[model samples]
Target: MLCIGFDVGGTNARGCLMEFTDATAPPRQLAEVKERIRDTRAPSQVAAVMADIATRLVEQEGVDPAQIESAGVGIAGQLDKTGNTVVGAPNLGWTNVPFKSVLVESLAGAGFTPPVRIVNDLAANVWGEFCVGAARGHQDVLAVYVGTGVGGGVIAAGKLYGGHGGKAGEIGHSKVVPHGAPCGCGQRGCVEAYVGGRRLEERLTQDYRAGRSLGLRPYLPVELRDVDHMHMDAIIRPDVADAAAAAGELYADGLWSYVADLLAMAIANGAMVLNPGLILLGGGVLRNTKELSRRVVERIPSYILRAAADDIEIRFGELGDDAGVYGAALLARG
Candidate 1:
């Protein structure tokens, strides 16, 4: 039976049809599709948009809707499993929205009654890794995903650990600095301040403003006239670039250093008291993890028990962005 996996991101919803084969048989990628949405604040509208896409996929792909064994949807926000509602999603301005019901109803409307599973995006990513990606065959693992925002998940003995209230893997909100830069979460110095895409742009934007004040950097070139603050916003002054790059590099280093330290602290303090066999790191930040991983791995030994650190292997995520979808499909299959 074919399973459908859907990744409901902030701006786009992606769907893929996949079939799991033997351990050696490569997973077949049957069909893939994407749908973009404006992400208006209305939860009903969001649900409608997702429903429309799922409906179209069924029609265009020639896949039997009823033959789809299961469907998994991954969302970014606080999920109330008991209520099946998206309790809060700051990015989409959603609150108490019945996302699961909406998906079920939408699929039912299209004449298919397959079970649908909904989970947090990071959790899905971890699920994907645990099933087929970096953490495959491992009983204990930590999957850290650094994208526009940072997120993480933990798997203990092959089962996902969804803590009380399901807020387990919210490392993005973990405070790195007290009273530091403001975050979209209305807090100061959250990890997002230093590493999120929006936050990275903010840093460069601030640098541009500073250089403008000092009259040391040229204004945007004619070609950059149409560019927004984010695109083409790096500190361009040769001297400024050097200084800013130094600062940016420091800021990046400091943030990751703090992340590594805090992660180690969490492990030392009890998160890893059991000593996970592998620490699998994935996400956009891990895209350039050579230096960061080395730094973290080097410092971790100082924080944790030597024996525990010795057995830990830190590696990059191989599934890339599909971790969520693949994992979600696994969720639906289960």
Candidate 2:
């Protein structure tokens, strides 16, 4: 059966139509639509955008909308189960919006109909990894997606754990410093505050401008492209490349140290408590997967019990930008 997956991120939304065959067969991306929102979109407007994207996929791909057996959305926001509303989505500038109702109505208006499921993006990400990506075959796993802000999802005992209030696996908020930098969530010392891409750039920017370090301010643009924040490399002007390389290395070092320390603590604690079989890391930061994973792995010994850590596998997420979409497809399949 054909399934539709929509990965609704903060900056943009991507939807895909896929034909799910089996566990091993990757879904075929029959059609896709990518749209960027200027952050001024209202809840209803956003719903329309999502509907339009889905409709385009069906029409462009020549697939019968009704043939879509199931559909799911992975959104970025705080969810209110009791009210069935997205309580607040700072990124989308939304609050107290009935997302499901709006989507359902929009689909109905579009003359396209199907059973649809909506979940937080992180949960969908974990589901994607567990169903067909890096965490496949594992009963217990953790998938962390590092982007503008770090986000995480946990699958325990073959099921996605969304926590009591749909706030499970908020690993980004895990405090790394007792009293460190400020975070969007209004918390201090969050792992995100320290290791998230924008913060990393800010650190480098401040350090470079202070004259306390090398005048490597020129590389900021190229190095700061991953998830809109400090990509490993972007070939640009020669001077920019040189500056970016130096800034990138400095950013990477600080990022690694912070991630290794906090992630290890979180994983080790989780290992002792939940004993996940594997931990999968992905997202923009993993653009330098080899370096990121190696550093994190090296710090495992200091955090986890030697015996428990021995059996655990720390791996990079196989799916790249497709992780959320694929996971959303998994929801549709189920």
The number of clashing residue pairs in each candidate reads 0, 3
Candidate 2: where is the Cα deviation over 4 Å? Answer: 215-255
- Which regions in candidate 1 have their CA more than 4 angstroms from the true location? 23-26, 39-41, 208-274, 288-290
Q: Candidate 2 residues 179-244, lDDT tens each?
A: 877998998988888666666556655554453333344344633443222332332222232333
lDDT of 1 by residue, 148-229 (tens): 6777887888888777888777766767667877877888877666656556545646755553322223333446545554
The candidate that achieves the highest lDDT relative to the unseen native structure:
2
How close is each model in CA RMSD to the real structure? 4.9, 5.0
Error of 2 at 319 (Å): 1.2
TM-score of 2: 0.86
| Location of the lowest summed lDDT over 10 successive residues in candidate 1 | 237-246
